[model samples]
Target: MAKLRPNLTDVDPVWNRIRKEAQDAMRNEPLIAGLVHSSLLHHATLERAMGYRISMKLASAEMSEQLLREICDEAFDSEPMLGQAVRADLAAIFERDPACHRLLQPVLYFKGFQAIESYRVGHWLWQQGRKDLAYFFQMRISEAFGVDIHPAAKIGRGIMIDHAHSIVIGETAVVGDNVSMLHSVTLGGTGKDDDDRHPKIADGVLIGAGAKVLGNIRVGHCSRVAAGSVVLSDVPPCKTVAGVPAKIVGEAGCDQPSLSMDQLLRATGE
Candidate 1:
């Protein structure tokens, strides 16, 4: 059994910042006060707020929001990493995305962030052998966010899925920490080789928009997959690949391609 990590005691500055922002928004826009209060101010911690937000977004006629909130709360309480990951993701978006100015945007507005958090709860349920509930989460997330991430897909911390539309991660896909990808990315299988047949993306990899990385291939650490590229083979570390069948076009250009969010090829590129 994995050890239950320590519960957060110190007041999270990120949560405080979010609350402050929410308070300001309430004053600035009187019309949205109700929405702001229910989503941000009503909850105490980031985890609780996230749970409520996700449950509210993904709830259906069949599943009540109250029940889903409990499930999400349980997941956040049991898995401290989920809370940590939320903070990391919030930070990642604020740091990497040029459009994101405040910490409140991802939590209250961004579908990508919400989808990933929902997937984390589903992933926790998957680990707990609640396959049915996990599948339900996958279904709702796909319907609500247009992102289909399998619950069994192992994604690490600090993930930023920009636009996040049409993002499909296979059941066996393993994405490492601090990875960033744009819209229409797929970490899918080559065919029906069900057993462990998905891409293993290393840390700090930047997968550009409309890129499809198929099969049980390894995208090495800090590599960049250029937009609209189809990668069928393994990518070496710190390299840039572009084309239908992606080739090492050049160096990754920066140490952290994901952090840089730089998709443009350098002048020296072949």
Candidate 2:
């Protein structure tokens, strides 16, 4: 069973609580002291620690850890929004995931959070016109985390991906704020038409496991896409959709479907 740590109301409190958790972890298990020290205790701030952690995880034969760390540091330092997004992401996981006891879990153990942070650095690189470096980050993240999010994909803050295995977000995909999804979700395109392809998932949307949303369709805000559904068209705001070539089954049944994390498909009595 997972032991819950100290409560955190916001990003600042989260960092403080994570430090406390790290201290406890070191005292309890000395074997991982060095790991905890390097990953969590060494840095002065969450962004700095994240820079070190992601670089260490994604470093390859082509790119050394020191170089990767420098790049990540530069990204974190230059792009303030990256850190903001990261904080939001952490908060999203802590609040939404039942298994997550502390903010440290997402920083250290969650591949979804780590992958998204790495993708943020990649997106920064892309914005700076360093396409090759961005692509490199994309490759490393996919290889290490099994979550293939294109560097060009525009993802907003406070996103949570549960059991985030085999998740794919295409280049033209746009995921909005406070959105949540489970494993094996694909925001992909229908064909080779490269321009403006892939799905646009709006704020507070909840996408279920193994759901495939194809093409340049809009999934409106606060919507719910059921598990194993194949969505090829636009979904209206606050609606629940299901089945292959998914249809509107019912209302979202709540204001924020993502926050609720409810995948229940109440029969519409159609």
Candidate 3:
């Protein structure tokens, strides 16, 4: 087992908590001691650890782990907000997902969190006018994680993608902060237009599993989209929408539907 470091409360409480969890994990499961130490305790900061983790996951025969690690380190170092987003994403998973018992779980195991972090790095590359490199990151992330997010897509912080299988966010899509979506959700275009042709999901929205919000539409803030719904038009704020051609069935049932992670659709009267 890796020796526990001194309390890092004064430096970074979140990173400190994750390191503590990692040490406990190593003690509980000696089989993963090397994995935990190499992945967590080996780094001095969360950014360094994330760079190592993302590179390990995305590296392939086409790209060496060392090169990918360099790219990830550059992204994390060049942009401080990336680190902030990482912390917020960790908090989101821990607070919302029942399966997430510790902060270390998302860092060491969850594909959703890993995919999102990889997307953020690709987005940074895109913004730096390195489109081809960004595309490379996108391809590797999709191939590795089964989640496809265009590097040009504008996604805000504190986002949680549960299950994260077959998720497709188009280039023009804009996702707001604190939004949560389940597996197989697609923010895609209708294939008719060439520009600005994807969905704009507002803050605090809860999109259920297999939901498809197609076209250049807006899903308003604090709304709930029921499972398997096919939304083709704009949805108003604080409303619950369901059906193949989704409609406003009722209220969102709470102020922050994403935070609650509640998918049950109560009757309008009930």
TM-score of 1: 0.96
Instruction: For residues 1-270, write the lDDT of model 2, one tens digit per residue.
Output: 222322333446657788999999999999999999999988877878999999999998999999999899888778778878998999999999999987899898899999999999999999999999999999999999999999999999999989889999999999999999999999999888879999999999999999999999999999999999999999999999999989999999889999999889887753
Per-residue lDDT over 20-72 for candidate 3, one digit per residue giving the tens place of the 0 to 100 score: 99999999999999999999999988988999999999998899999999898
RMSD of 1: 2.3
Q: How does each model score on lDDT?
A: 0.94, 0.92, 0.95
Model 2 segments more than 4 A misplaced? 1-11
Off by over 4 Å in 3: 1-9
- Model 1, range 45-116, lDDT digits (tens) per residue? 888899999999999998999999999999988888899999999999999999998999999889999999
Candidate 1 backbone collisions, by pair: none
